[model samples]
Target: MNSEEEFFDAETGLESDDSCEVSFKDATQENGVWERRKKLPAEMISRNNFSVWNILKKCIGMELSKIAMPVVFNEPLSFLQRISEYMEHTHLIHKACSLSDSIDRMQVVAAFAVSAVASQWERTGKPFNPLLGETYELTREDEGYRLISEQVSHHPPISAFHAESLKKEFEFHGSIYPKLKFWGKSVEAEPKGTMTLELLKHKEAYTWTNPMCCVHNIILGKLWIEQYGTVEIVNHRTGDKCVLNFKPCGMFGKELHKVEGHIQDKSKKKRRVMYGKWTECMYSVDPKVYEAYKKSEKKSGGESKKLRQERSCEAEEADEMPEVQETVTVIPGSALLWRITSRPAHSAQMYNFTSFAITLNELEPGMERLLSPTDCRLRPDIRAMESGDIDLASSEKERLEEKQRAARRERSKDEEEWSTRWFQMGTNPHTGAEDWLYTGGYFDRNFTDCPNIY
Candidate 1:
């Protein structure tokens, strides 16, 4: 098989053998009415004919967002819709909100943070960048939450989102400006933004930033992705903290998908040790057990190193990669913190989207009448792509981009500033950093002042 075909086979695999037993429910409430689509109109088009290296050859070491990528490289969803995926595991936030122990609350919050990125696994396709003034709203009465997101800036491409529970239990909001760079063999995304979650019941606020994610082997060999960095989540009210280390895939791939961390109390005393694979599940155990496990692991590593030295020549010549352990080896007393929700049976053919994600772009009959003029659901390009019209999608995407550019030039000539509708740039009360705070009034359904970006 060709490299691209081989990559697809490795990435998507076969249709699930248990498809017959899998639930295909797409039930989500809208306006107290239940209706949703379980699948996109068509399966994702194959990438076998495209050569990424040809497009990225001269763009190495540059910010990728500045380059114009083809629509084929993108899934049907916009970046605003992608941001909404963060809410898929909102139950973790509710769990954290209900806990009385500060340390216990911190553990659940940490799991929620990790779970936020779990949807990206094997999802190599990018989301379409939102036009300036574009917006997306997701309301799930069943989940007791509603989210509103907007493309606040276009030049640096900032996307700001706010989500709150109907019962006023918690508030989650953030403004992200990811810096994407192409490094010849890989593409790296540094999510440069602060994410804040507030538990209204406890009056506690937590803040943290996402880790750097890298897609490797872009030019050759099998493609893979890894997240690597230190993420520090702090509770402002309780002075508690959780530090997680997303390990990079080393030469032997032994550390692939591993996440390890600890939760500390106000006094800097370690309260619990957490470890797991971010792709599957997370577990928290007593600090003493973690330390004993580490000691035993270190001794085993010492023995492996000696054996490696004896066969150093053979190892250097070996082309095979080590098999990654799929499941986390839980200690006897470890408590389950969080586990990923399974994707739909058709996920492999449908952009690798989770069940929650499959509903993000579903535009039910008459739904557009309720959305703002600038909502992403009205974007013709995305709609065309979703309907499996590749040529129309490509043409519409180009036209929309040109329209955006023309509008920018017109505003520049008139010396006018673009005004955001739902969110405004302001100082975050908790972090004291400049952020896009939701100005409310979005749910009031006044579309008179909304932009005509679509």
Candidate 2:
């Protein structure tokens, strides 16, 4: 089942890696990655004519069911209004398949080609893609964000590093990122650089990767937070706005990701006493205690045992405590920008991104939009050994061979199943008669007894 133990022809695959990039400007073809852009009738808009803004307006009532939102929206556009818009863009995606002209197909397909080029627009608004169940929340801080940082010791968790490196590789070789208007103005800059392999040996891979969408990173003094934090709104998950009064603390909960503030805790409730962390983490500490430690550290002398005991019980550890987070309000425009990718390479293997660009003037009144979201951040991961390939060990090579054999067998079995059905059943009444038999019927009807059928 897990063929990771098998050896991969890294050199052959990486060195001879035939990868191409296209853009809305120029496109080429692959195994149907891009199809012709059909000449639609007078009243309709081609998918290309739809900008990010117009598309969002279109998804208002379309039923997504269980689609992968992140893959479709490369970045998170979390707002309901935006989600509805993007959905409309996809409504006509089937048009690409309908076209018959080569140029039209190229134009359609070219829209999907990645040109070592990237564009970034930094806005602190929840940019969510319903297609992919990934979200980005921009907040002042992400204290218990799974992990804030890591070190590379003897064999450190190279987890975050790999994904970051992939992003760098793409930036080095990809397209020029332009500045976003609302994000500010752009300064002159150099075009992106080219990437080439250079280094090393044994490789360890993980089946799971970073979340479908990237979360925003927090800095102590930065004015805007990108992906996760607290915010105001109807809890999209449960639809509760935290307006009901419960026990003391009058029904409080966490903040909305991307937007800042506890979406549930309103300033109007009957002066409810609130203290503690937003999450009911088993080992959560009170924020009061956390502050006490800082206070104690600044004191002139050593702490007494009684004082130490008191310090341990302080509620500084929990931020939700009314004392620490006094202004429980969200200053909108602080959410992550999740972009939508029209067509995904593989439905299951989808990629979505949340991005931000850090600069001195970004949050300033007269902002500089120079650092586009793609420039400041993008989760493009291209993995290949710098030296081209790693040699496979004997066991690994054998394992690879075994895996290939198993795959071949499975494919053959599928072919056999299809072949058997072809000879047993017959054709369609809707279309002209054909030789192929439709196998879908056997599962539902008793064909042996039915006298009248299509």
Candidate 3:
């Protein structure tokens, strides 16, 4: 058999034996948005170069074509309908709900992403559509009521894939190899999440109405792992340091990073050394600790001799008989697993987002205390200078305001462009509900009638 035959059995149009039922739920919130006003320092104000609303344009929903940077589509309804019909797991929902309530440092980071996105809408009258609708409390915003769309689109528990991705990225980013392993997507494993955060002493802790844990540079994914998932972070530095407190999204743990202590000057140059150095060091695990972690995989057959013998023989024969191996391979797909692509419905650059970047911003006395003298905060905010200090500050301030107005204008233009495309699809907001009014990044830049996952 060839790749076509093994991965896609076009002849039978049959799906794999391993499949799960998916469902969606509206998060248990009335409006799926937080109600509040953010107050910035009188002198220093911060604005976004990129709107959080834009992140929605990029990631409003998931699509099958997202696998390729440039995607192709076939069987529109069959494809998306299948994507919507993910596996139904009560345990997953429970865990998701549980995780969404975590208040850990990592959880705060996720919340900040939501808050940041929501802020953009409030600031610019744009919309913040959510994959999962959740709320801090009862409140309404100017744009409209945000919905959590608790429609849990279930697929295979992607923890192993996620962990593997993280491991690979961590090694690459840290330049140190740990015991990285990518667990194949597993059916038996329940997908759940928790958070652990170690705030370096020098990093700024933004004190909002609710203190939030700010994580810079990385895409802060859903808090508590898609509402009920697992994220483990082992702090090899600070034995016990809790630097943040915020609204509960789920349960979390705390530890400090090892690089914080070696700093002499609390300057950007010094912090840079620590951040770049230790994150690369591979934290070792004790033999006992490593063994205990294998419990999750213990049930998949307990490493039986018979299984090993069969696997060894199969490998031996595979070298000599390629066709036999091909015949034995399982085709992985679903009758529902088709693809969807489209012309550019949104702005060209706004449609496809590589990922969401979130950071906490402090209002007053901004950078003065953001990087504490004792804290070894990495990546201290770099303020670009335009001229001599005073003249530069005044000119830059005016320039920032002008850029903001221009951004608002650009957003309006993008909306108009998208609206033209939406009308082309014959979708009417005022019209009564229709059967399949699925519009997302899929029809936008996601598919672009090209590859996916760019």
Candidate 4:
């Protein structure tokens, strides 16, 4: 068994794929996002004592699931930021609204589904739990999209979020409750919920489930994350569906980032195949073209007309591609691939985040002016973390937690409970479960008429 600090500051250094003799300090600062830390936070270090290690070993071996870890290592951002990470790639879903054919829409939705996992790769830091009724909203002026998320329940830790692009006629809404399990060297977090997205123009609705996320090497090695399981997105009205299976990495680290799946009609046997390494890109090809591509792994001479046609369809539609990266445009053909875009820089390099991952916690420019005092974006502790003042961040975090405790005490004494602002508790007709539902409507409601309650 390894000591608590064995991987943190070992004199011999930790093993890594890279040849350079990188210390934990140097490795974490590799991305140049934030300066190297002198040591781990005092709380995290103190919690790593012998008693904590013994408890972790026994509890994890027993597979005592649904257990919560201590909050010492939590990031300064709120859980609302974590929920909004799904919307960072909303442009993909919005594009589905413009496609007339169900096949094209399925492809866009599959891309949307796959993009959600991009932010979780290599990310191990937990976000702070949002206070009851705390809210967050992000409005993209250029994209004409708005996202609103709120902490609707505190006891079971549920968050509800809604996003829409009125111009694109696309909307997404869902609630998430993460089920956590500790396993000695790793933690498994599976979101207990379903999400639905709708395209108003086509009157199409798509629903999908989330996969399990595993945080690896918490005690003996470098910390990172992996997500595995099949995520199926179904278009209820069109009967078109895409089943994406996220491949888990092996013990020796083989097959890292590989994913394969297909899109097919509900009744038809024919399918369009898609496969690729998710960390880089995902490519789609017709079944026949895919078989041919598989056979011609080394030969470049064999190209099909169907592949050329698919390529032309994707390339000709410049409107479907996001303008985040210039390298997004690829040669049209049977191998149509969507590469992950670049993300904003992080404070440390430990998390190998994709381009949009950094924006997950970002309160977009000028958003403070529109935010209410109670909004998570206005939290002092989170702001301190964002600015790299870890000490101040820790102090502010303690202060906020104390404040929350006091508020809860007062509320309990007064027999009062917090309620959500932008969302309402409703029963899900399909699942028969009570969940938070967004009340804002695209065509029926006006934003100007909505109150600024945050």
TM-score of candidate 4 on Cα atoms, chains taken together: 0.72
**What C-alpha lDDT values do all the predictions have?**
0.83, 0.20, 0.19, 0.62
Could you tell me the TM-score of candidate 1? 0.89
Report the C-alpha lDDT of model 4 over 1-454, residue by residue, as the tens digit: 1111111121333333323212212233334442223322222222244233444765664433333334446654587877777765666765677678888888878877777777665566777777767777655433446677877777778888888773658888889887676776677888878888888888888888887787766665456666788888888887888888887765323345667888889896557887765555677778887676667764775547564444331222121211112222222354553556554344254234343334444453554445555567677777666566666777877777677668779889999876566789898644466767887642222334332322
lDDT of 2 by residue, 1-454 (tens): 0111111111111111112211110022345453222111111111232233333333433322212221222222222112122111121122223455322322221221111011121222222211111111111111101001111110110100110121111100011111111211111112111111111111111010000111121111112211211211121222223121111121121221111111222233221112122111001123354346547666956546564443341232221212123232321222211122222222112121211111100121211122112111111210011111212222332343355346447757887321121022233222222222223222121223321100
Q: lDDT tens digits, residues 133-167, model 1? A: 99998776555677999999998999999999877
**Deviation in angstroms for 183 in model 1?**
0.5
Off by over 4 Å in 1: 1-35, 299-322
Off by over 4 Å in 2: 1-50, 56-58, 61-283, 286-454
Best-to-worst lDDT order: 1, 4, 2, 3
Better model by TM-score, 3 or 4? 4
Better of 2 and 4 by TM-score: 4
For candidate 1, the lDDT comes to 0.83
Report the lDDT tens digits of candidate 3 across residue range 1-454.
Answer: 1111111011211232213211111122235542121211121222223233323234323332222110110111111111111111111211222232222222223222122212111011111111111111000111111111111111211110000011111100000001111121100112122222113231212111112222111122211111111112222222212122122122111111111111112221211001100111111222243344445457565656664444431221111111111111111220111111111222122212101100112111332222212111111111211111323434443454355346547757888421211111222222221211223221111212321100
In terms of TM-score, the best-performing candidate is 1
| Cα-based TM-score, every candidate | 0.89, 0.16, 0.17, 0.72
Best by lDDT: 1
Model 3 scores a C-alpha lDDT of 0.19
Instruction: Please give the RMSD to the true structure for each candidate, in Å.
Output: 8.2, 26.5, 25.9, 14.8
- Mind sharing the TM-score for model 2? 0.16
